[model samples]
Target: MPTKPSVLFVCVHNAGRSQMAAAFLAHLAGDRVEVRSAGSAPADQVNPAVVEAMGEAGIDLAHARPKVLTTDAVHASDVVVTMGCGDACPVFPGKRYLDWSLADPAGQDVRGVRPIRDEIERHVRDLLTELGVETEGVETGGVETETEPRA
Candidate 1:
């Protein structure tokens, strides 16, 4: 890993899972890590439900637009995480790759997207640990826990 590890999140559509994952990493890792996200087949806009779910967590995705996956993106990152993008992502030597078997958030409502968003947060936290990034004292966007009641 480089002094500041660069991570790329990829999926079939850049609208939901990848977007959430990248946001969590960026929020949690801050400037300690470089984060990027893309899709094999990019969506025209971000999923509305995803935006709402992330907003509930206090991280806004309203302005985020889907981006297409590129070979150069894969080459530029130290780690590449794929979420249901399957074989669409290109493989290159010396780049660490991880495939997260996450559900596609397409057409899902905010309630349905909440769990996926939290799950991505967990994974992003683990990834930060693996990359030796410290997350202490970082203010999270207030993701709700299972036992917490929705306001």
Candidate 2:
């Protein structure tokens, strides 16, 4: 890893799972890790239910927008995490790649998106552990546990 490891989160829409994962990683890792998120087919806006779910965790995604996946992004990242983007994501050798089998949160309500948000949190926590980044005041399996929020 570089002095600061960079991670890219990719999904099909970049509107839900990838957005949530990026937000969680950014919140937990702070500036210790560089976080980026993109979609295979970018959407116009973030999924509203995902935004609400993240807000429930005390993190905001209200202004988050979808980003396009690019080979340059994959090349720049030390770790590339794919959430159901499959072939849409570019593969480059020598980069750590992880594919998270997460449910799409596009059309779900806050009730349905909560679990997915929690699952992404868990995975992001695990990834932080693997990257040797320590988070403060974040509790696993609890939606309300938090510290300061970040964008």
TM-score of each: 0.93, 0.90
Reference-based lDDT, residue 95, model 2: 96
lDDT of 1 by residue, 11-101 (tens): 9889999999999899889899999999999999999999988877778899999999999999999999999988899999999999998
TM-score attained by model 1: 0.93
Per-residue lDDT tens digits for candidate 2, residues 31-97, read: 9999999999999999998897798787889999999999999999999999998788888889999
Candidate 1 residue spans exceeding 4 A from truth: 141-151
How accurate locally is residue 64 in candidate 2, as Cα lDDT from 0 to 100? 97
In model 2, which runs have C-alpha deviations exceeding 4 angstroms?
138-151
Model 2, residue 150: what's the lDDT? 26
